[model samples]
Target: MSMDLFSIARSGILAAQSQLGVTSNNIANVNTEGYHRQVAIQGTSTSMRLGNNFYGTGTYVQEVKRIYNDYAARELRIGQTGLSAAEASYTKLSELDQLFSQIGKAVPASLNDFFSGLNSLADLPSDLGIRGSVLNSASQLAQNLNQMQSHLSGQVQQTNDQIESITTRINEISKEMAQINLELMKTPGNDAQLLDKQDALIQELSQYAEVNVIPLENGARSIMLGSSFMLVSGEVAMTMGVTTGDPFPNEPELTYSLGGSELKADPAKLGGQLGALFDFRDNTLMPASHELGQLALGIADAFNEMQSQGFDLNGELGQPIFTDINDPVIAAGRVGAYSGNPGTASLSVNIDDVGALSGSSYELNYTSAGTYELKDMKTGAVTNLTLNGNTLEGANGFSINIDAGAMAAGDRFEIRPTANAAANIGVVMSDPKGIAAAAPKITAGTGNSGSTSVKLVSIDDRSAANFPVTDSELTFTLDTSVNPPTYEVFDVNGASLATGTAAGTPPQISAFGFTFEVDGSSGGSESFTFDLSFAPGDNTNAVAMAKLSDSKIMNNGKSTLGDVFEKTKLDIGSQTKSAQVRAGSAEAIYNQAYARVQSESGVNLDEEAANLMQFQQAYQASARIMTTANTLFDTLFSSVR
Candidate 1:
């Protein structure tokens, strides 16, 4: 009995001490991230038998375990992933939104300044300085737009860097978790320290990707990312790429592939930070930048055309207005003689002098012996002209065209004619918006409210049969929607269309010297532009260039530039709001799961204190047993003496 008592006292003391340690650990890690409170599980010892009678031994320690709910842990992990994605998306886009707000300031009053310079010239029609200033402003605005674009592009590059860095971080975490999981398997059943390490790692992981947990028989964990396991059987470890070469997709396309199998996930359908980046590039940034380009082009074309038509200080016709579009290469193209001749020559057509433009007329020529016939680029037709004393004379009033296809990259055209010619030619450009004469004032709608008031803005000759000549359909583009809208098109001579919306499955339109099918449809109508140029003899009273500049041609007499920018800003706002809402919902779900899991698995101060009391009491009872055993042994030894 004494022996049994001594053994029981010894075991109870050890068990109580272990329980106290566990409870202490629980209290210590209460505020620790990813810490799961532990429990000291105890079980009764086996009954000791001697002869027919049986006697029970004292209680013994069974195991030290975590009070975690696996289900809750899984839910918490998934929620964390979604929340991380949302926050990341919001932060990045907000930065971009702030950047875009500086557009107007960076290129302050571009069109206004250009026109103001013109007004100055109109006052002093023969001032070279003013003429040069006007040209400078026009070119300067173009440069400003180019600079702004460069800045936006830099932002895009930075986003790519962030995405790649994040991916690489995710991979690092995955590899560490995998390695830790293996080490844990060998470290005697559920090492609390190791468990804490792994849980901490997983929680950190929630910041990047969505995760799924798999529990093994030995309390080890493996993880999955949206169905495909990122970790498996405590092995086959994978490292995620936090950084990649180009993280931001230029066109913002999203696709998922598994062993060459492309998954059907529209980037829009994804609900994470990654998805937000895709949406920004695809729907917001890309679209806005292109529109910015269009705005720059429109202003350049309009102002340049007007300036070229007006007289400089020398009363010479200005050069063709700035290009409808330009590139790094365009600035290099020299204003030169349009004659087909290989030898150098000069042009004296200065349309800038209003009086001269009123009666200005000439032709161009390019021949093997000298400058004679040059093709008009605008019309891609031949121009006829005769050169005399550095001045050019032509038939047909000097209307000419230059063909893009006919010219080579380095081909040069000499405008002054001589190596050091004294005279030069005027500017040539066509206005697409038709805003030269009118400052503001869109014509009021005579049609019904639902009737679209879309006016033609511009169109390139991308092809003969294709309407609007662009990738995306415009209002003027023929529609093949199952129920097509009934609208009038000036180019197709008022042709109407109707058909199913499926692309290439067509009922078609036959007009504009070509028969083309109506394919695909959109929720809203599109728009296009047409050329209605103003000329001197055409009558200022008629549909002349000056007449269109009237306030009536615009929306509420506001600059077209203002209208276009405002519309685009509204669209971008909606997209950002949508992202915020989605992210909020995800966060709410994560919080709910986290709380539930914390209730079961998280440390509790009061609970730990109470456990300390219970274990201490058990230890006291065991100490009493030891004292009793010693007393009995002392008595037995005294009897032997």
Candidate 2:
């Protein structure tokens, strides 16, 4: 009987010790991150039946179980992913927004000054000083645009660098998580510290990307990204690599391997810092840079057109004032096929019309054998392209020429017609006298050739279709024998556009982009000649060019040059504001989800303190039982003696 009592007491004491150890451990790690509260499970030992009466033995400690709600923890990780993505996007966009704010101060101001100089030159067409000022202003404007483009290019490189850094960190974390998982597999359950480390690493990983954890055998988990692509599985971790579509590396592309199959993942859908970086590059920076390029192209093209219609001081046709602004940017895809002897295909794109430019990038894909498809990156509109020999035309306002080799199926190219136009723009006119401030030729006629008083009215070239003619000589022959004094008009090509009688309230005649007036004529053979010459004081074309400031030449003929810049600014502001609002909302949701997790798994000091006192008393009671049993044994022995 005494030995039975001792056995029961000894078991009770061991059970109480375990309970105390678990409670104390919970208290010790209460403030530790990812630490789950633990409880020591207890069960009664086998009982003995004596005389049909059951006798109770002491309790034994089972195992210590962690109080972790798996569902709540998963929810927290998901919410944290969203919050981190929003925060990352907002942070990057804010930096972009600040950079774009300088647009008004730099490019717009320089453009305004350039145009103002042109207006001044128009007022004083023969002033050499004003011509020099115009040239200087143009140089200044081009310099400013180049500077801004350079800054934006640097930003792109900086963004790529950030992506590289983030990817490196993600790889490190994945490797550590895999290592922890492998360690966990060895001991399985009862490894609380290892589990804590694993959970903490997963949470940290979620800060960089959206991740999902799948429970595997032996208390190990596999971390996944975007519903697929395991980042860390069991004892192995897969690494993501960054590849740029272009050599400049404006946008970062993600690549990974699964079962020896390489696949590309869209960074925008990935979530977290990596996703946000891609979003900023593709959605914000690329478009804004292209718009700036569009503006540069528009300005350069319009001014050059007007310049071509004018004559310089040397009586020569005006050369291009600025270098080419219509060059396209080409990017080769990482995945493509090459064939033939040359093996490589070269594409050259040139803008056909500024008014018809879509201000968007295009993807040229060799879909199948002998077939090509073009997709607008902005609108996702696909157009079937016809290959006309080496050149592909009739798309948007541009043409692409495959200058070399043969393009194989599955080959892809990114064509940006105006994305870098501003960066490459320069003032090609070195001499101020090269500026075209005069019309190619002034309207002139033989003064009073016949009895009819003939005078040059006004040349109207303000119409979009009515452009100034580059004529060296035009002849107008008058026959005054008729009652109304009929006259025949001929252009520089000697083509008669108007003949017979002049009919109008002002008795005007229109021909060769000009109108003529005649009054009081009689029967006589008269001839008039309009000659084109380099007149230093001619400002006809200059005046016409100045009016282009109000013309709808951008946004598919819906907005002017100034309007495009204004719209770009507004777009940046709107995107930044939207990101900020989303970030706030995401933070709120993450907080709620995290609070739920904390409530389920977090340790409570008050409860642990109460448990500590209760366990201590239970331990003392078990010790007292052993003491009483020892005293009874001693008393029995003494009585027997």
Candidate 3:
């Protein structure tokens, strides 16, 4: 009986000691992150039977269990992923929003100053000082655009850098996770510390990408990234890499490899920090940059067109006030060939009409021989275009000229007509005398006219072919005797060149790239003569250029230059605001989920202290039992002696 008592007390003392050790460990790691509170589970030992009566044989610790709820953990991970993405997007967009805000103020001011200078030039067309000032303002505007484009490009590069850094870290974490899994498999029983470290790494990894953790029977975790790619399986980890994108080298593409198989993953669908960066780059930053470039192209092209329509102070055809819209380098930069293309085919894009620019990128894919499909990146609208000779004219304000080798089927290109316009735009004309402030043609009344007047709107490309080499005159006569007024245009030798019936309202006539608007409300025979001479004092072209500030010559003649910038600013601002709201919501959810997880698994000092006292007292009681058992054995021995 004494032996039985000693054995029972020994078991009780062992169980109490285990419980005290677990409670002390919990107390020691109370502030440790990712440490789960542990408890010793006690179970009754086998019973002993004496004379058909059973007696308890004390207790033993079954296992040390970690307090954790898998469901709560999963919810916390989801919340963390969402919060990370939202915060990442908001941080980037807020920077952009601030940049545009500053740019929004500076650009419009410079634009207004440029236009004001043009207006001043219209007042004094021959003033050299005014011309120089106008040029100065124009230079300032161009510089502003160039600076803005530089900033946007820098943002793109910065995003790429961040993606690379995050991906590299993710790869390292994956490898570490695989090692941890291997260690877990080799470990004999549940190693609480190792499991804690595994969970800690998992939480850290979740900050970069969305992760799904699967528990294996061998006490190892198999992790997957966003439900598709397995980052870690058993003892193997997939390596993640970042590389330049196919079509746009400035952007980033994500790739992963497991064993010998390599595959590409879309960063936009990754649903974490990586996804946020890609989404902002493609959908927001790139689009905004394109819009800014479109504005620059529109302004430059319009001013250049006006310059071509008039004569300079030197009495020569006006030179380009800015760089040529079709400069070889600039044009070639507007399109990018996909790296996956098997063909050496290359193309150049030329802006045909600034007003028709969509301010968006288009995908040109070669489907078959001499066949292509153009897809609008913004709207997802596809248009089938067949190659006509060596050119493919896009309905959207641009034309693609095949420059080199032929393209094989499945070849692809990305055409961004205005993407580089802002960066490449410059004031090429430095001479003040090169400013075209005079009208190319002088209009005068010839014969007795009833209330009809004609004025030259603009001179087009055919003006050079139609105008005589020397100073000459063209006669335009309108005869109202016919049902619809008949108009005749005559050359310098009095020989009729062309005759036609004026059909449209407020009758107009177009000849040799010269469009003349005839206001004939008085209804009578009218004749006008156009003197093909340069008038340096004429400010007609300058006046027309000044009016361009209010012209709706962007977005298919729907927006002005200022309107485009404002629209871009508003778009970025709105997106930033939305991201902020989403971030707030995500944070709230994350906090709630974290609270639930901590409540279930977090260590409590008060509970641990109480447990320590209870186990200590139990230890004392079991020790007293041993002492009493020893005393009884001594007594029995003494009595027997």
Candidate 4:
């Protein structure tokens, strides 16, 4: 009986000791990551033989379990992932802030300065010094654009390299994770080290791109990239690659096809740090460079074309500010380039707006296989061309393109038929055609009416003046004295040509396609009237009577003839000002999210210390039971002796 009693006491003591041990362990490892508090479970042992009443064996350990909620663990993972993405996005976006902050002197600043210089020139229209200043400033503006374009192109190249590096990293990590799963499947239990390593890897991977992770039966996780690349599956990894910057400024883009395989945007998916960088390079930085290029190209085209009309300074015009892209379509399409012409009117190429063009001229020359390239003179960024066009419902310039997808917002462009020389007309039309013979597109009627007639001397058909490139033109000339007189040059249909004054000097003559220059006449505001004309689609006008005293001009100073040239210049300084503000806001949001997540997951030593006390008391109580059991056994032995 005494032995039986001792056995019961001993069992109780052992059970209590086990409970204490569990509590102590929990307190000790409170700071250990991924360690859930464990509890020792005790149960009554069964009797070997049952008679009247079955009250037999003492106690036995049932199972060692965790004092954790399964639901809580799942919640933690969900939150962890959310935080991971936020943190990753924030980290990646931070780089954009840095990049934008660094984009100086060439972008917005130069743009604004360029226009301001134009304003100064307009203020002193006849100041030779100011004129030189205007030219120099214009040239400087182009230089800034070129630099900016080059910078953006560089950024694109860097982004592509990053994409490659990111893909490689993801691939390696994915394979490692896959292997871990296989090893885990063969093993009896989970390997904590593998789990931690996988977690660390996931955190790292999230920085570059967003990912979807699925846990397999074997304790392994499968990784996918942007629903595109199945980076890792069943212990295998598929890698990704990238093509660097475009070498041609006017071309579109080329994808980094994976060794002649499909374009892998998955492992190379544009997201996380990669996405922000891509956006900056393509959307922000790249576009800015392109705009700079556009501005440069536009001004160059304008000034060079005008130089043929004879300006104030140099005997001849200088070279184009930036180099043209190597593409035949540029000189072939609606916005085709013009070389030389002796006609009184020369060609004028005026872009409707810079925002209207694709990232570069390459979109017009997208390759059949959907591979094309264009160099960014600013950031030197290169990107793959998705799609684009100069007109709505535009054709698939490249066969592998979506049909006139969506026009990017802020886009603007137009190709008005222009003349070739200062006094040369480049409109392919020599006269109205096909509609009414011996009739004109526009006719002049005497009155207070603003009707001006367009006369095409050698009419092609004289019927359909409602067109461009038909070789029909109005004959005109310029004066070189004070300044060129402003003339409203009209088309065959009496529609305005791209706005500018008629040539102002050297009394040049043209049989066809001469540029409109200013007339050096009474007050430099002469209006040369044309004869009867018809047909439509012309939109050119003289520098619409630029009067500084006009209240409209003083209020905003834009959209008018005088301010037209000024409006088109770059605005680098203004752009930078706004970019800095945007960067600041993004930074704040990132920091806040980061702080909130850390507070919840981090360890607190003070809380653990408090838990230690409770476990110590339990330990002491269990020790007393062991002493009582031994004492009882000794007393029984003494009696028997």
Best by lDDT: 3
Q: Root-mean-square deviation of each candidate, in angstroms?
A: 18.5, 9.1, 6.1, 14.3
TM-score of each prediction = 0.60, 0.81, 0.88, 0.55
Best by TM-score: 3
Candidate 4 off by > 4 Å: 1-50, 54-135, 191-200, 203-211, 227-229, 234-263, 266-280, 312-611
Candidate 1 segments whose C-alpha is farther than 4 A from its true place: 49-54, 115-133, 185-188, 220-222, 228-234, 239-271, 304-559, 577-585
Per-residue alpha-carbon lDDT of candidate 4 for residues 535-560, written as tens digits (9 for 90 to 100): 22211110111122121221122332
Q: Residue 246 CA error for candidate 1 (Å)?
A: 9.8
Tell me the spans in candidate 3 whose CA falls farther than 4 Å from its real position. Answer: 441-473, 476-529
> Per-residue CA lDDT of candidate 1, range 1-641, in tens?
98899988988998999999999988888888888888888888888999999987877889888777767877887788788777766676666666656663455465556656656644544444654675676566666666666766776777666656655676677678777878877776777777778887877766655566787755578876555434344754654332121212242232333454543334344334555565565445655654454355444444554533332222122344555323223322223433234433322322111111111112233444445664533245565556443434553322223422333222335321111000111223222112232211122223323333322222222354433322322223323233543333543243433222312223443333223333334434533332222232222221233222332322223445444445556655665676689789988999999889888988778888999999999889999999999999999999999
lDDT, residue 377, model 3: 84
Error of 3 at 384 (Å): 1.8
Cα displacement (angstroms), candidate 4, residue 422, comes to 26
lDDT of all predictions:
0.52, 0.77, 0.85, 0.42
Query: How high a TM-score does candidate 3 get?
Result: 0.88
Candidate closer to the true structure by TM-score (higher is better), 2 or 4: 2
